[model samples]
Target: MKFLYILGLIVLLSFVIIYYQFNPEVYSFFPECPFHKYLHLDCPGCGSQRAIHALLHLNLQKAMGYNLLLVFSLPILALQLFCKIYSYFTKKTLLLHFWYSPNTPKIIFVIVMIFWIARNLPYPPFNYLAA
Candidate 1:
């Protein structure tokens, strides 16, 4: 488990470095969102790559423009990551406790679904969500 965790960390760091160094918009090697390609609409994570790039460069406006959802959720994700690391070190853990509270999954699901749908809407504020 420790080895796997280290491997995962390395892979994640590699991706972060890559995102930091390359502009996803101008790079052909970066993976495109298949959901947008197939459905012709922005999904919840459509601009996450570009957002990461912008974030790595400390461009908050551009990052939020790319993916507001991702920017807004980073703190929660960081907290969950911290909880996981804490649990892993202690060896007494609830695997999903930090991010889940029975109703949490349902609530998150609803929110993401709503964002996914709203981002596709062609109206004023909704269209702003498109990446």
Candidate 2:
């Protein structure tokens, strides 16, 4: 199981490295988001690919410009992933108690929905939120 996890990480890292070398925004092979294609509106995940590409290249400002939500959420997500992996390897949980609450999922969902809407707004300031 540990080996599989490590292998997955390696594969993912390799992909990121490749993506960093080749900008996804210029790659014709990268899939366009169907939600945005049909609706002509930016989705919550619309710029995530470009953001990851920028991040892997150590361009923080470009990453944030592509997807601020993804840029901001990455550290928290990495910490959560690290905690899970640590628990699996050590059989001892780390900071699990601090993350869980009855309303956490609901709150996260609401925030995502709000971001989705805000990014799709056709006005100033909010319009800049779109990719």
Candidate 3:
């Protein structure tokens, strides 16, 4: 099971690396954010595709420029993913499951909402936040 899980993860990562290496920004097939299209506002996910593309190419600054929130969140998300996969394979928890705390979700939601609103604000520093 562990071997299968690792194999699956490797394959998935390989595909993602290859796809993003091609640069989703230039790819017409990559779907544009519906929220931005309809509302003319930058959603929380506006530049995620370009961010991922820049990340895959090892351009950290470019990735952050595309989506600063996503760049900052990747490490936390990766740690959570590592903890989950580690527990699954070893049948023992690794990281303390702080994500299960009731306040965590609320805090995360508030942060996301703030980021969403801040990015959409049409002002100097706030405008720079938009993709």
Query: Of the candidates shown, which would achieve the greatest lDDT relative to the real structure?
Result: 1
- Could you give the candidate ranking by TM-score, starting with the highest? 2, 1, 3
lDDT of 1 at 40: 98
TM-score of 2: 0.89
Encode model 1's per-residue lDDT on 71-115: one tens digit a residue.
999978877787788889998774656365888889988999999
- Whole-model Cα lDDT of every candidate shown, in order: 0.89, 0.88, 0.87
lDDT per residue as tens, model 3, 2-61? 788889899989878766667777778778899999999999989998888888889999
Show model 2 residue runs off by greater than 4 Å: none
Q: Who is ahead in TM-score, 2 or 3? A: 2
| Residue 11 CA displacement from its true place in model 1, Å | 1.0
Best by TM-score: 2
The TM-score, computed over Cα atoms with residue i paired to residue i, of candidate 1 is: 0.88
Give RMSD to native, each candidate: 2.1, 1.6, 2.2
lDDT-based ranking = 1, 2, 3
